[model samples]
Target: MRKLALIILVAVTSQTTWADAVSDLKNYLSSTQSLQANFKQTVTSQQGKIQNSSGTLSIQRPGLFRWIYQKPFEQLIIADGKQVWLYDPDLKQATVKAMGKALESSPAALLAGNNQFERNYTLRPLPSREGIDWLEATPKQADQSFNSVKLGFSQGQLMQMELHDNFGQTTRIYFSALKINPKIDASQFRFTPPKDADVIRE
Candidate 1:
């Protein structure tokens, strides 16, 4: 029947599109070594309160990243491969922990680490929207913090990420002005506590 044939055609086309999106994401991740971008993040609580923050992010492969939140407040999170530091300027406090322990359930770990995506997550493509190709990644670990993560790419550049956590909180981050494989100084990943700040090592 003509109608049955049309339905099959549509299903095949959808599957092909999904496959292409996943392949495109894998290729982009494999080719990128360093990246810098400006980001806007919105976190919505379970009760529906929304908070917005803007920041700049720089990341290097093999687990190094710097996230600086500059709007509404100033907070810095840096991972120097072996150690991770979180500094709250207003509170004059810094917390340090081993990177492996701190990033176990973090989205940053997925993006910045050298882990194989297929091994750690089940990836599927979402319908394209607003000129962006979207992919959904569900972590293999049942105990992970987030329920699911979605990544969006525009012309092979990572442009957005959305995460749904177990506690019913959702965080969406939009990336703009992305620079791929940029020349980043290694010193950018290092953090030093302010002289007057209290440092707590976890």
Candidate 2:
């Protein structure tokens, strides 16, 4: 009888812990309107190919963001509320896509998208690890570039994200010096291709 009671108690406690983690994530999404941070991204391929890059990120909720990669090569991805632009300075090329199509089932959707989490993803809490509470979100859509995403939070602040892609690559991003709800200039989200650059519209 004591053993059975102990098992039941443990299960209940585990469930409550998971629920709390999910709640923390919801509160964070609701409270954060704009955010800026320095980010480091590491990608590991199935064959063990690894690449590391560092960048700065800025986001305004409901579809506005600028992601800049500074190391190794310079690349910029900006969402101007209506269109998403990807520019490669070295290649002198830019690609444009509608915001909805570009962000659908993507990590950018989770961060800078409208607060429609449940509509696009099925979220669940993961076991706490490395001093962070983790949450896993699987996209509901059948066609997605990524298989799943994991978000790690420390003290309710986002710390890390892992995206498992369909191409058998895992991209992990660590965010530091995060400023939540900070004042961000609108120009940050706007992008214009250089006059000499080749622009490809998708």
Among these predictions, the greatest TM-score belongs to 2
Q: Which lDDT tens digits does candidate 1 get at residues 58-152? A: 99986999999999999999999999999999999999999774464467766797756676788876887887788888888888889999988
Q: Where does candidate 1 have its weakest 10-residue lDDT segment?
A: 101-110
Q: Give one digit per residue, the lDDT tens place, for model 2 in 39-150.
A: 9999999999999999999999989999999998999999999999999999999999997654856788888987778788998778778778888999998698889999
Clashing pairs in 2: none
Give the best candidate by lDDT: 2
Candidate 1 overall lDDT versus native: 0.87
RMSD score of candidate 1 (Å): 1.8
Q: List candidate 2 segments past 4 Å from native.
A: 1-10
- TM-scores, in order shown? 0.92, 0.93
lDDT of each: 0.87, 0.90
lDDT of 2: 0.90
